[model samples]
Target: MRTTKTLAPLALAPILALALAACQDRTDDAEDPQSASTSEADAAEEDEEEPAPVSILRPDIEPPELPDLPEVPLEPLDLTIGFPEGGMELDEEAKATLEQVLESEQVATGAPIVLRSHTDSEGSDTGNMRASEKRGELVKAWLVENGIAADRIRVIPFGEQNPVAPNALPDGSPNEAGRARNRRVEVAVVPVPEETVPDDPADASAEDAD
Candidate 1:
């Protein structure tokens, strides 16, 4: 019985020692500033590392309004008709070109046709003018014969005054090619202006009655 009692005290001694050691460790952890700071820092880092909640909603947006662009005016019909060297007569090529011109919408619409004739600088001013006039006359006659009204045609002879190319080269030599290009007629079909009528027909009638 004494031996049993002594063994029980020995077992109790080991259990008490373990409990004391556990208490000491808890006390040391509470007392240490570095341990407490490290625990707090770990908790703060965990909170900081957590991702924020995201929204699935999209923002409403609109495209900006654009301004209206102005209308562009149509250009007049303009073309050049070349003539043979020292000839006021129309050849097959010239006739074909005139046929094409006659087929144009401007010609069909009865647009006023202006024929401005030009000549090379080989002849005198008076002779060149006369030649240009004759050239213009021949083209006018052809147009008139092809059902175009004579009143709608206007002929303006420029002779050698308005040349498209130089009559002579830089070295004072006659430029035959340039002179050839210079001898031609410029045909322009001008657009007729629209007659402005009163917006209100009744008002126009009233004014006429007055």
Candidate 2:
């Protein structure tokens, strides 16, 4: 009986040790739950507090407006007068044509007209130059006699230096027809600019009073 009582105490010692270890493990598990929950909550809060990234694209810019310009006057008329064959005098048809051109609305309004005369390569350069000048002066005189203002006309004489026809004739001789064709006058009218016109005196006075 004494031996059995000592063996019973030895067996109870192992069971008590096991029970203590089990209690320690359960305590650690219970403590870990709260710590894990706190960590998860912290992660969620950080996600909610963060801002989204912005774009790098910019808005389009607009162009500025341009200012308006003042208007210019209308263009003038052009008139071509051919001289007679082998003659320096103005023909009847050419004179009539000149009269008609001068009577037009553009020339009547005192618009500036430029008269350029040319001669063929038939004559010497010096003679042709003189002829061109004479033709231009004659036309100017005719316009003046027909009531056109002298100030509104300008004359330029370009002799054989500028030929409309080639120097070679059909028969291989210097063609007089080409020379005659070159010996002509061209009239060009140029309109005045709107800005050059004088302002009304009444409008200026009214603005000053204001």
Candidate 3:
């Protein structure tokens, strides 16, 4: 009986050893897939954290700088309109000159226009003043009829006081040519007032939007 018990324990020992070895192999196999999955997840996370490198189509070449343009000053217009001998009316030549002047950039900006009218020293001072005033009114009326605002025009009658040429020559003779030049209206423009700019950036932006 003692011999049988010893033999039975020895026979069962190999089976027990085999079962423990099988369980150990299965555990290692299962843990290997989980470890591989964890390694793959860590590799994916690294890829997400790193940013891709930017590719430049033209890294060596740079754009050229443009030159600044020069600013030109806007000068006031100084034009003249001459009348025929002893006539307060504007002839075709005078009209042509006025049209050309009005087309100029200096005069086309709707600025205040000054018309200084003058006459030759032919009549009395009072008569010359009245005639010069009449001539100026005629010119102003014409301008109003042709789309110019009446308020924009200012007529100043100089009469014979500001004659371009002497009515009589140095030898006390009538200088017809000089007298003819004296009957004219000097046309000029008032300079435009400069605009005030806001110092605040927000105010400037609001003005731009407006």
What are the TM-scores, per candidate, against the unseen true structure? 0.60, 0.56, 0.61
Tell me how many residue pairs clash in candidate 2.
Answer: 0
- What is the model-wide C-alpha lDDT for candidate 2? 0.82
Q: Which one wins on TM-score?
A: 3
> What's the C-alpha lDDT at position 208 in model 3?
85
RMSD of every prediction: 11.5, 12.8, 17.9
Q: Which is the better candidate, 1 or 2, if ranked by lDDT? A: 1
TM-score of 3: 0.61
lDDT of 1 at 23: 100
Q: Which digits, one per residue and each the tens of the lDDT, describe model 1 over residues 1-210? A: 999998998889989999999999999987899977989999999999999987665556555689888545336888878885658778787788888889887777667999999999987999999989989988999999998999999999998999988999999999999998988888899766556889999999999999
What are the lDDT figures for the candidates, one per model? 0.87, 0.82, 0.85
Query: In model 2, how large is the Cα lDDT of residue 100?
Result: 75
lDDT of 2 by residue, 99-179 (tens): 877777677666788999988876688998898899998899999998888888899999877778776666788766676
Model 1 gets an lDDT of 0.87
lDDT (C-alpha) at residue 69 in model 2: 86
RMSD of 3: 17.9
lDDT by residue (tens digit), candidate 3, 1-210: 999998998999999999999999999988789888989999999999998988775878877788888546578888888875778779998899888776788767778988998889888999988888888888888888887899999999999999777789889999899889988888888669566767898988988899
TM-score, prediction 1:
0.60
